[model samples]
Target chain A: MLEIFARLATLVVHDLIGLEAGTGLGDAAHFFVEDTLKILFLLAVLIYLIALVRASLNVERVRAFLAGKAQILGYLLGSTFGAVTPFCSCSSVPLFIGFASARIPVGVTMAFLITSPMINEVAVVLLWGLLGWELTLIYIAVGFLVGMLGGAFLDAIRAERYLQPFLAQAYQQGSAAAAGGGEAQRLTLRQRHDFARKEVGEIFGRVWKWVLIGVALGAALHGFVPDGWIEENLGAGHWWQVPAAVLVGIPLYTNITGVVPVMESLILKGLPIGTTLAFCMSTVAASFPEFVLLKQVMLWRLLAILFALLLVAFTLSGWLLNLVEPWLTTGAGAGG
Target chain B: MREIKVLGSGCAKCNNTAERIEAKASELGVEARVTKETSPEALMQYGVMSTPAVVVDGQLVHSGSMPEPGQIQEWLQ
Candidate 1:
């Protein structure tokens, strides 16, 4: 699909736009057009599918299920749902509000928030296209585990003690109100479709510019950045590369849409898989904005714990990938 | 004409809120212009920490989740 889109973009740029190949302008434009179209196309399709699944997941059903689940299971379910659910990136506020209002466990909600942005369908599609299916699957599995374990650990530590008092009070009131009217409303197919369509529109509206900017950066790096610079600085030889990638990634925030192309370029240029994955995961999962959003409901301590937990988890993931990359590449070449 | 803005990020509930507001305004035989704000900054500016919020004229009538149909009707009127 990406190849076809790349070809179409090439045809348009070379034939329609009349831009000659090998020039800086031609290369950048070609990269931009191709990358943007591929990302957008994947975004629309994946988000729609996720929306369909989410519609069936139904808020009331999820709340009811969580209310009855075991402690470990709740964290696992929260993060697993977060990975598959479509709303993690921009719509987290509402999910947070919903979970709080329903009086879902704070730790469980934290798990969901952590996994949602990290492993949504959009991120998976991009990873599959850009990095291949094996890595995408691996990312999904590992990312889900991170959320589950992270949430469980936090809960065990009684992290709830750290949430803002006002939020808990609000949650208590919210739960009281919701209890009186808590009923599942089955949505028709058309309603689900409309909901999905608008979700696509809303996300597209916010991130379209970032897609361009990210792709442009990727393209620029592809065309101009010295080939060995990334590899030599941050590639396989250095054991510190994974941690460094995580640290750098936190301060630099970009969604999978913006980060994936850059990831593709770096991979093609021999940047080590572990370092790259760590950076990608950190950029999407452990960033400052997510923590900032958490602050609305949590005191500094809980927010700090979440960040530390994610940073550690992501760093471990990076090292684990480093250890397994050779075995993975030798075995399957990561989805041929 | 009443200027009503649905402050949200284009999520499911936001779309529903926008539609209900439009429908309620129309049902009441009121002339109204409704706008959807999908920008995060703009939505947050209206204090919509949670989405599917309603801004009537320039004031925040509701924020953080969808309002009930009855509430929508009251706001529109």
Candidate 2:
């Protein structure tokens, strides 16, 4: 598939535009252009499709669906909703309020919140395209586990008291309005098209700069970063590598789709699967901006705990994957 | 009269927000001009990173989701 892109890219850049393509610098330039186009195309199409699906629904339906479920069911449903929902992490606040006002437990809400950012369709699709099926499945499973367990842990500790007081007041206000019964209107096809076009523009416009930067960095790493140095320092066998990756990844703002190529390059430079994926997960799921936004509704202690939970879960997942990787490789060898 | 800017990417929620503001404004007997800003740059000008923000008279009144009718009414006044 990438070969097909490469051939088409060569025809356009080299044949049509008559640019250089047979040298090292040319290859790097081509790689960058190809990757950028690929990601942008993918982002535009997938985001538009997701927006189309999202356009047909309202928050009230999501609220009603999740309002009265048990803890485990809430965790399951919340995580699933988070997975498919097109919401950016910070933008999910209204849904968070809906859950709160509906009296859904804080843990369940956290489950929704965590998974929404961590394992959205963008991440899943990109991981599948770049990293293949096993890794993608692992990402999904770990994301779900983190949401479910993190939520349950928060609930077990009675974290509701840690919410900002205004959340309750706001929820009460919002709930009263909701209970008064407003009708949900269906959007016309033209309206859905316009909405999707606008959403595609918004998301693609915001993330394109990051995509270019990420691809450029990935190209550089692919070309210049040495394998031996990386393997010696941060290879799979290193016990501290997973936690270190998580800590470093926490401050970065790139999404999984943006980070996967860089990760692919790092893997070429001998970075471990566990460590690379750990970095990707934390970068997307545990960023500092997400915490800053949550502070509007949650006390610092609860936010800190939530961060810590993700940190621990990702680190453990990394270590466990590293442990099982050799066995999986051998199993594959035997089977295939 | 009020200048109500709905900071959204023109998604359903944002449209809903714009409509609700219009509804609330008329229901309360307030004459208001409602506009929707879909551009990221325009949204940033209002310091709204999230879509579907309601800005009334150039002050950001709400963001991060659809504003309820009551919240819209509260903000408009």
Tell me each candidate's TM-score.
0.78, 0.77
| Tens-place lDDT digits, model 2, residues A201-304 | 87776678878888888777765565477878777677988998899988778866678677656766667777877888888887777777667678899888
DockQ versus reference, model 2: 0.11
Q: Show model 1 residue runs off by greater than 4 Å.
A: A14-28, A56-60, A88-94, A97-103, A168-183, A330-336, B1-50, B53-74
Query: Any residue pairs clashing in model 1, and if so which?
Result: none
RMSD (CA, Å), each prediction: 5.8, 7.2
Please give, for residues A197-287, the per-residue lDDT of candidate 1 as tens digits: 8778867876788788889988897767676887677667677878878888986788778988887777766777777778888898866
Name the top lDDT candidate.
1
Q: What fraction of the native alpha-carbon contacts across the interface, defined at 8 angstroms, is recovered by model 1? A: 0.19
Off by over 4 Å in 2: A9-27, A168-185, A328-336, B3-77
The lDDT for every candidate, in the order shown, is: 0.74, 0.73
lDDT of 1 by residue, B1-77 (tens): 88889876566777888888888888898888999986544643443445667888898888755787888777777
